[model samples]
Target: DAGITQSPRHKVTETGTPVTLRCHQTENHRYMYWYRQDPGHGLRLIHYSYGVKDTDKGEVSDGYSVSRSKTEDFLLTLESATSSQTSVYFCAISRDRGTGELFFGEGSRLTVL
Candidate 1:
């Protein structure tokens, strides 16, 4: 919150590992998101970017992979990590997406074994 910043808050790899999660924002909000919080599929949407580089793909985008050239940066990759894709990953930012209002980043928990 308050400018978002999510790094490797916690992680434990295995099962063809290759995880990378980093979302840093200095309030350059143009819209950037990557969410995943399992346990009943509470929060889906695994990709988003509406500015730097422009991107799309959500609703649990298969495998997951995203990047923003700049504007604060947003990256989430799991090139080859699986195990039901363990859970907990959030990085959100929104200046205005129809007033949806989103500004989160204090989560990054991955465990695939």
Candidate 2:
């Protein structure tokens, strides 16, 4: 994509540790989202931000947190890493909030052992 970046493309950590993933976008869109993909569950939204310093939790946000201090940057953090939290995380940007069209970044894979 022209305007998206995900840091730590791959990461491995032990259980009970903490991990953070960063997403950067250059598209200047008002919507940025973080999602996790697993085998059966497919993709599930973790959090999203409509603008700077404005964010809301998603369906599976129990152990995760997100922050967007700037329009081009969004961060996702796992307070305490766990095996079940292992999955591929993706950051998406879209101009239209209700539309399905979005630009996604290269996924970040995390493993917890």
Candidate 3:
């Protein structure tokens, strides 16, 4: 395996609740990303980090936020879960600098009721 992974391959949550998913990587790479995949739409970036405690919002960062306090750990938090938020979440990383090509995790399925 390269060095990236996501946890809780499957999750079910109630509407308006808060949920947090974990992404762990051993690569120690400088870049980490979170993307959500939904039918008909391409993967949308939720957030990303350049280094420990260095992060920023991405295109679809509204209801989601992220934190990276360690080089090997990045956490994504869904402030208020909704049915619309149900989708497959993927954690990605790049061993190289910003070339845009990313390594993806298997994916985490989240279902909100």
Candidate 4:
């Protein structure tokens, strides 16, 4: 985690509650991404940011929202968490999307009961 930081590494919350996970990076990479890992689904992209204030939704964007106010910080918010949302979230940084090299944070484990 040289350039990345994730807060609330572990969380337990009830269904329908709101949850937010924060990812901070010092590498100043141009692209930051949010991904969730589940047993059957493997790793799925939730959202991504290309630059400050420039973000986009990913394949699994439903039920998830993301914001990036600065180059080093990205936020992921689950408006209303659900049991299906229980998964380990990872933050990855990359200079370019096609580079095939992504620096990932340890992870943020969130369990929605």
Candidate 5:
């Protein structure tokens, strides 16, 4: 098993409130990424970290931000949520970047009103 999990498997929130999603892994891998899946858009990256305290932004990182303070935990924060941001978020990890073979968590369903 890849040993990754996403929290708040389901969620519903107001349009303008802040929401935070958590990803936990037991694999001790160095690469962790946050992505959101929307209809017709495929998976879009929000943020990713190579190692603890080492992070970088992804293509669709406007309303989202992330932090990785520990090897096994990465957190994604929506500063001010929006209806457009309503999507299923997934956390993924890879043992190596060259292979591009990613293992994804079940996903977090977020509904915005």
Candidate 6:
């Protein structure tokens, strides 16, 4: 289970509406990332946090924002979601630099209409 949990596993929202997906981890991992998976794009990074209150933007972060205020919680927000943002969002946790392997959450499916 990786001790990771994503909230609102499925969501449907109208265009221009606000949406927020939560990722909660019990393993106390030091690194966390948010990614969106699509048919052709595969998985694109949205944002990532290395520690509490330390976040960085990634390739597909144009319409998204993220916050990490605690070691166990990371929040990804879409201030104004659009249909183009509809995808399966995944949260991944890594305890090491690149060898410990990543632990992924079930996923949050967001549909914007």
List TM-scores for all candidates, in order.
0.32, 0.96, 0.95, 0.96, 0.97, 0.96
Each model's total of backbone clashes: 0, 0, 0, 0, 0, 0
Deviation of model 5 at 53, angstroms: 1.1
Candidate 6 stretches greater than 4 Å from native: none
- lDDT of candidate 3 over 1-113, digit per residue (tens): 76777888899999999999999988778898999999999999999998989999989998898999998888999999988899999999987655787888899999999
Q: How much is the lDDT of residue 60 in candidate 5?
A: 94
Model 3 TM-score?
0.95
All candidates: CA RMSD (Å): 11.8, 0.8, 1.0, 0.9, 0.7, 1.0
Best by TM-score: 5
Tell me the tens digit of each residue's lDDT in model 6 across 1-113: 68999999999999999999999999989999999999988889899999999999989999999999999999999999999999999999999757948899999999999
- Model 5: per-residue lDDT, tens digit, 1-113? 79999999999999899999999999998999999999999999999999999999999999898999999999999989999999999999988789989989999999999
Query: Between prediction 2 and prediction 3, which has the larger TM-score?
Result: 2
What tens digits encode model 2's per-residue C-alpha lDDT throughout 5-55? 999999999999999999999889999999999998888999988889989
Give the lowest summed-lDDT range of ten residues in model 6.
95-104
Worst 10 residues of 1 by lDDT: 1-10
What is the Cα-based lDDT of residue 30 in candidate 6? 98
List the pairs of residues colliding in candidate 5.
Answer: none
Worst 10 residues of 3 by lDDT: 94-103
- Please provide, for model 4 over 61-95, each residue's C-alpha lDDT reduced to its tens digit, 9 standing for 90 to 100: 99999999999999999999999999999999999
Candidate 5 worst ten-residue window by lDDT = 94-103
Of candidates 2 and 1, the better by lDDT: 2
Alpha carbon lDDT at 47, candidate 4: 96
Off by over 4 Å in 1: 1-14, 19-31, 37-41, 44-69, 86-93, 96-113
**lDDT of model 5 at position 24:** 97
Model 6: what TM-score? 0.96
